[model samples]
Target: MSSTATAAPAKKRGSGLFQGLQKVGRSLQLPIAVLPAAGILLRLGQPDVFGPKGLGWDKVASVFATAGGAVFDNLPMLFCIGVAIGFAKKADGSTALAALVGFLVYSNVLKAFPVTDAVVNTTANKGVDVAATYNNPGVLGGIIMGLLAAVLWQKYHRTKLVDWLGFFNGRRLVPIIMAFVGTVMGVFFGLIWEPIGEGISNFGEWMTGLGAAGAGLFGLINRALIPVGMHQFVNTVSWFQLGDFKDATGAVVHGDLNRFFAGDPTAGQFMSGFFPIMMFGLPAAAIAIAHAARPERRKAVMGMMVSLALTSFVTGVTEPIEFSFMFIAPVLYAIHAVLTALSMAITWALGVHAGFTFSAGFIDYALNWNLATKPWLIIPIGLVFAAIYYTLFRFAITKFNLTTPGREPEEEIEDITKA
Candidate 1:
């Protein structure tokens, strides 16, 4: 009667919710795929690990920084393009074009709202001032617009207009719908963007206010939700601008990564803790999992296990190892989460602020090294956690007889001889 037994059926029963969520998760890949380059460039622009801090490194680093900043700055547009393409039922150019059209409609309409001001300002030539305050609405806004565009594209792409107006039928008709959809969206957000933005910012502030405990909680939630693939949504708040930070520079930063690069003193509240887990802890788990395999299977599984460990350690991708035991033994995963939470708390308390361009792999760790408060601290923390993860995973897997991958029941295997 373990919850793990019901997880699959429960997912199937909630097919609508799960499928849509799965699609959103899948759509995220495109935008995320581009992040590593940006992160590397940003790191290159920062003062080197051995050099002094501040803008001095900008001369050489500026090229890379600006290159990377464009991606960070225009995340919304990228999401619109990425998600529209991802969610489109068919690979058609119209869907992508329509997404852009939708984005422009929302951007332009929201800017010119409160008609009197738009008109008066235009006449008085104070429109520039009005434009100055226009909020870009960032990634969250982009996701919404992208989803809306894809839905419209899917629904309208095949529509046929009356023969008299047939020229605007089929693919041509989608953009027309998106234009209206975008305006409606624009008008909708124009009135309430402030409250919505403020609410999210407040939620971020609340999370950050709890300090190390908040980070620990996030770590637990992050690992806990991986079974459902919904952790990314939770992470979106911290990685992007779920929280708002207004800095001394009179500029505003919304997310952990954004605030960190913006030179906000409190940047990396959510990200700093993951380095230990990704670069070391998970790899150790991989090793333990491999070692716990029956000796015969151990040799067979070692190559795969080693690759998973290296991938997680080098690039911070953990799905391979996480999937190894996520379902067959939920208890182990729960323990893993608890360990992750502890790691988060420890690192956060120690004030290690290294953030990542991609995952908390060695690459990002090295890149964000100089940008942190005590980046060197993660090295020792990660090393210690590796031993902890190895010992804990080995002991628990053996004690509970958890069926992690190569150690699965023999009868469960598909035999080619029988087939």
Candidate 2:
């Protein structure tokens, strides 16, 4: 075969892999969509918000807090089901059911193992034996099980079986296969996950130890990961496992978001910087895109860009605007990533600590104000970043003739929504 033919196949394979990753990334949005409501309810239930002096409804606050906490507590299962349904060929009920079965079996099997903190220290004097929950894999495990369930369902949902097994040959086979596979996975993880888990835990600690520099690196990597959808994995570590705090009830909480909500003064280091990027920087970039459009196309571009800008400002959902220019102007994306790193470092140095349940949007910034340290600083910082983003983006777009929104030729114009 000609080298050109071989190159074509390689290109197709690369495209297929990229598409697969994008699918996984998109799948994560399903579960993440629930966090904002949970965060709102949880915050509303806080003493500073709706408790004693405010609504004077302590019991109601407790109920709201518990209701919201339930979602965070069950994130692993949610991710499992969400990913399964998202990746399944049909997004049907059966795929979700299979994912649940797989996760339950995998988790319970790990629980069955009598693992201790140390191999030789089983006595209470050295270290007490751990509970079944010790084997819990958190959301990462859920994502794995979900992907497995999706794959199994996609491949075996319509497989034929022997005559006696005909009744279970179709959709029913999925859960059955998952149960067996889950058992195997449970045993496999039980044997191997200790070191893996420790490595992740240690990495999280190292990142925390790095302070401002670490936060800066995380910001840069987080933005770069957006295109491939792997940002959520890093987010899981940063938001769910980077720190530890004990709540009023003495229960331990982990991750920046959880610890912040649980009243840890030291939390939110990983989250504070995004406020400027999402709420101001990206919106300004949208403005630059709008300003660079062809004169005749500016009106239509503004209508679309305005919505994207407002979405970023209010909700901190920057994908609409980021995606608009990222592919067409990758250099701009790179610049955005570097600016994010700078923002993280600057925010950390300024002692501006803020937390969010959903994202670094206005809603979260305002909602968590009472719990934040120097929360007012975010506004000034955001404005400065906004100016920087607008100046840089406008200059870059003009110089490069980048195809952002309305700059494309009439025949080649594509929908921003689709991007």
Candidate 3:
């Protein structure tokens, strides 16, 4: 009885942890979803695109750039609000208000007590040496505070107070509580970061120094995590805070995506490798799977596979193709992970630097072309990968008799037909 009881609780704990993490991942998507629009505007406004020199829409392009820049510049604020809304039970305005209040308090406290020695002379700061004044805790901090606010709200939003203190009961109390909590959090982070700043900087340097091998490892792990739906955790760090770059205006940006948009010359290691796989390799694999289907099922499979292939090629949504074979033919998925890693490493070796705000689809590839290094080379490389994927997938499906997609058992197909 004791063993069973203990086992049940343990299982519950594990399940709860997984669900919480998945919630965090879903919450992160709310803010990330806004980036595509921002990216399109920013790219369109580039001087070589629709800006002064290219399309001669100087003032209009500047307006577009400025509007897009507003979103990027305030990403941390948006993240906090988004995370709070995502986590709230009711997802109401109160949660967002508390998140904003917490963020403001935390930022102001950091401004008063800087954590790093990095100084800036931006118009916003006016030559302040306070590291926390401008973009201190950053998106990571915003995420933390947002999570904290949500938890605090969940815990206290329904509490009843003594009659004397009734005015601060329930939902109205969240922001008030977060103000104090944010102050404490701000001071704590500031104290900790003073000694840890060098460590963080060194870690960033180490990640950048890993080069192709690092990107390859990231790609492999990224694909492996898809089955469990946990790739977002790995993605957030690499895309948001992996490397650092200083822009032409002397402002620093972090992460592959941010740096790429800021025109950092060496910011696409984590992103360039995806284009070939999404736009070519996976589509070819889908065709291979369709051809490998039973003669009777080939027609049905082709219709479904064609849509999946086009989705991957145009939007870079590979889950449809990957999931179709992942469960029935696990070996194919394993090979895909390895292939993704190889793609990342190969792209790095070829000095291909490209990026996408959403995914490495045809749209992003074309939109970011002017900013990419060796962008045209992706075509020949993609064609080669297409052939490789098709050949290897066809050979594997035939050799192992892997039941991919339409290759299900005759009994199962008959059952579906009867139903």
lDDT for each candidate structure: 0.81, 0.86, 0.87
Q: What is the C-alpha RMSD of each candidate to the true structure, in Å?
A: 5.9, 4.5, 3.6
- Higher-TM-score candidate of 1 and 3: 3
Whole-structure CA lDDT of model 1: 0.81
TM-score of each: 0.87, 0.87, 0.91
- What overall lDDT, based on C-alpha atoms, would model 3 receive against the true structure? 0.87
Poorest 10 consecutive residues by lDDT, candidate 1:
114-123
Ranking by TM-score: 3, 1, 2
Q: How well does candidate 1 match the true structure in TM-score terms? A: 0.87
Weakest 10 consecutive residues of candidate 3 by summed lDDT? 128-137
Tell me which of candidates 1 and 2 scores higher on lDDT: 2
* Residue lDDT tens for model 3, 1-419: 56555433346658988988888877888888899999998988899877877998898889888888888888888888998989777768889989999988987887767434565786767876544333355678888998998898888988889999999999899999999998998888776755554565576678768888988988999999888777877787788866778888677777789999999999898899999999999999999999999999999999999999999999888999999999889999999999999999889889999999889999999999999999988898899899999999999999999999889999999999899
Candidate 3's TM-score reads 0.91
lDDT of 1 by residue, 256-301 (tens): 8877876766777788888899889989888998899988789878
> Which pairs of residues collide in model 2?
none
